[model samples]
Target: MNLRKATLTDYGVPPDDIPALQSHFRHLDENDKYNLLQVSIKYAPGIETQIYDSIVNCIGYRTMERFRDMPVSENDFYGYKRKTMAEYYHLAKLTGRL
Candidate 1:
């Protein structure tokens, strides 16, 4: 699902921690990056549960929208991945979080 920016900073990660976070993010391979995104978003203001469900393979997209939980709609949505590596990098550069 395409939502707002979800960089470390966008998730309310503090500025002091961002450099280290980005440095950590930089070294991760694809699988690790995917895992990192999952863990990283766990306590974000919103979108946490959705990301968690994707990781656990527990809930379906329709369930979230049907229950009026996540703000996603079927039209603008993809299957599971909430954010892409490209997206993360883009937002990081945009916000100077990279």
Candidate 2:
């Protein structure tokens, strides 16, 4: 499935999050990115494990690629907006769930 379709069906994310999600998926197509940020806000140990597993298996080397490309500082405004979604992913891991 296309990114938009996969994102919608698998994660149930709203249309607003799509652009950001697509940016992240361009770098790492891992499901955890969607599940953690798009789904629940609460954290759980099981979710942490799931995120790790998904990241390790699906993201693989692409994680670095995506992270490196991620926006930092003001010059990259669009990138910064995209980074917000990344932040959600980070929060998911940090909180050990989501």
Candidate 3:
């Protein structure tokens, strides 16, 4: 398996670590997810492809049940739908839909 390392440049931020972004997102309130998504989409632009790949690399493939389940009822800030933001990114890559 190949591993992909992410940096602030990947997310259009000045910081040098993607793990810190992951940790922050993990603990952030659910409502903040959209705001975070918007910022990511705006600043990172094409970073979605890489973000999807990185999430899959980190979490492995999500179970079908977990993948399809909707954890967030809100329309995606990125206009994609899935169990969670990570799952959206993962599925997008898996299906070549991103």
Candidate 4:
């Protein structure tokens, strides 16, 4: 299994830390989740692909349920076009994510 790591400079979060994000998201209120999604609606700059890879690495460290069952609602990132964040969100939504 390959491990990738990178800082989402825009959000100040390492994309490889999905587990922590999941745990924290679970404890947050609806508004807080929305705010977090809003804040994470973008990536740093030129590392979108690395961010995606890191997210995949992060997901590999956990069960599929953990990624799929994030506290985010279906409409959370509805219209956001953030590449890195989008990669993570869409991967979580994809059927049979590995």
Candidate 5:
């Protein structure tokens, strides 16, 4: 799935998130980055919610509030949310669920 930059942007990921997305990319090898991006755009905005819930393993009213970039303390994973998103994509692949 060779995704265009515009494709990801069109998926509703805010432009401000590019830096965070790049940070996640920094942690991945080229192939893994491509795979995760493919899964991500395949699922689009909905995947944002799914990944947030999965990453936090929430069992309550945790909602997807944590997906945004907030103060470091308020953010889950302490500014590593994008990396966590990537992890969720990887997990989805392992389970063949996404």
Candidate 6:
């Protein structure tokens, strides 16, 4: 909520306008998602504890289904696994995980 300390405010978003920001974030690509995660952590530190954790848990479960349903090889599966883990790590860090 501290605009001066928040990276999001650099994008001209006010703290009171987070819902709209979140809606916009939902439509971004993977690279954009990762970038938003970083920006979100900088701007809305509490979101990791509040929203990011829940989203990571949900996406982690769904990634399994996606990987299985895909035609990728074991190596590719590992890549996806790593990416998922990285995403979780960022989320956890943002959320203040141990």
The candidate scoring highest on lDDT is: 1
lDDT tens readout by residue for model 3, 18-88: 35545544555444544445544643355443334333334333332255443422223123212234343
Every model's TM-score: 0.32, 0.25, 0.30, 0.26, 0.27, 0.30
**lDDT tens readout by residue for model 5, 1-98:** 22222233444455675556545544665565456555544544434444443333432224334444322232332223444454444454466533
Which segments of candidate 6 are over 4 A away from where they belong?
1-70
Number of clashes found in candidate 2: 0
For candidate 3, what is the lDDT? Answer: 0.38
Sort the candidates on lDDT, descending order.
1, 5, 6, 2, 3, 4
Q: Which consecutive 10 residues in model 1 have the weakest lDDT in total?
A: 76-85
Misplaced by over 4 Å in model 1 are 1-45, 75-98
RMSD of 3: 12.9
Residue 93, candidate 4: C-alpha displacement in angstroms = 28
Candidate 2 lDDT tens digits, 19-64: 6655554464456556544432233222343333333345432353
TM-score between model 5 and native: 0.27
Q: lDDT per model, in order?
A: 0.49, 0.41, 0.38, 0.37, 0.44, 0.42
lDDT tens readout by residue for model 1, 39-69: 4364333555565454344455677677656
- Ranking, TM-score, top scorer first: 1, 6, 3, 5, 4, 2
TM-score of 1: 0.32
Q: Residue by residue across 1-98, what tens digits does model 6's lDDT show?
A: 32223243343445565454445434555655565456446533433322333243334324554543434443443333333334444453455431
| Location of the lowest summed lDDT over 10 successive residues in candidate 6 | 47-56
RMSD to the native, candidate 2? 13.5
For model 4, the run of ten residues with the poorest summed lDDT: 72-81
- Please give me the total number of clashing residue pairs in predicted model 5: 0
Instruction: Tally clashing residue pairs in candidate 4.
Output: 0
Top candidate by TM-score: 1
